[model samples]
Target: MTQGLDQQHPQEHRDRAILETITQEGRSDYNLVELARLYIRYDNFPGARQIQQDLQAILAQWNLTVEELFTLTRAIHQQGQIYRRTKSGEDIQDWS
Candidate 1:
């Protein structure tokens, strides 16, 4: 006769469950820069401006500059484009 065995550690099982939940819920970017870009790209100017205001509030909270925020926004936009292209299986041509 054969006996059944329990193989999963409690912590490992909990971690896997948590990860599955998060993956099913999808990715969320709470960063204002990314939120603003999403709004702007979709032609939601009012929403984008609202997010900009929120970004300003965050900047004030962290004592950061508008220039730094712009830089972050640019980087996020670049990464988004790359991600989109990759997801769509489109060839990205480098003209540099």
Candidate 2:
């Protein structure tokens, strides 16, 4: 009998473990879209919410406003947006 994804990870009992892997394991960092999918995979919406809050807190450390983070997140692509240049072909700067 096969178990589930939650049973696969060693730290399944630890709620923080999932978030920790996002940073420590580095494979699942940010990537909220991916994280959401992962949460769905594990059938863990509650855990997903916790992870979302944790990620938001981490990003808050950057002093980014909610609007800025919203713009940086690509909902259509379901991925994080990394801006290298503005629409005018200039490098992005002075983002707060």
Candidate 3:
């Protein structure tokens, strides 16, 4: 039974272990964003909301206005999509 369970969701177990390590190291906005992404990917909306709250707080503390942050987030998301589509796995090239 234990082996069956282990084999059934190996990636989930790995993700949990990684999350545990990150939590033990203490939470940060960057960590929260990563957690949110992981939760979203796994279809865990509640967990993602919690992380999003943390991210909001961090953005507030940094005095990042909502528009600026949204712009940054959109750019990052778009870049990731482009990289994934290209399959070259290269970093996004700087325009300036």
Candidate 4:
């Protein structure tokens, strides 16, 4: 239950780091998007949706254009397709 970062597999360590940062800052469009993607992959659908809503609010606060929103959403979707966000925190490369 309490694995040390050094003890974790490299991929697991990186995965845990990302999750931690997301919780710690939970700010910035980039971080939110990444967290959302991870949530989606990890089967936390509601959390992912919430992050998306947060993303929308962030975009609105910045006065971004519809075109910008479309672009960002597209990129996020594409990434979700590319990366298999697993709860195990396994390294993507290790899949091979």
TM-score against truth, every candidate: 0.31, 0.31, 0.36, 0.33
Best by lDDT: 4
Q: Candidate 4 — what's its lDDT?
A: 0.50
Worst 10-residue lDDT window for candidate 2 reads 1-10
- TM-score, candidate number 1: 0.31
Off by over 4 Å in 4: 1-12, 44-96
lDDT of 3 by residue, 1-96 (tens): 232332223245555564665566645444444444454444423233434455455446556655665555566666554332335655442211
Q: Model 2 TM-score?
A: 0.31
Ranking of predictions according to TM-score = 3, 4, 1, 2
C-alpha RMSD for every candidate: 17.2, 11.8, 9.7, 11.0
Per-residue error at 30 for model 2, in Å? Answer: 5.8
Ranking by lDDT: 4, 3, 2, 1
**Which residue runs does candidate 2 get wrong by more than 4 Å?**
1-16, 25-53, 75-96
Q: Write the per-residue lDDT of candidate 1 for residues 4-96, one digit (tens) a residue.
A: 332333233433343344335433332444433332342323233433344445457645575665666677667765333555687442211
Clashing pairs in 2: none
Instruction: Return the lDDT, model 4, position 68.
Output: 63
lDDT of each: 0.43, 0.45, 0.47, 0.50
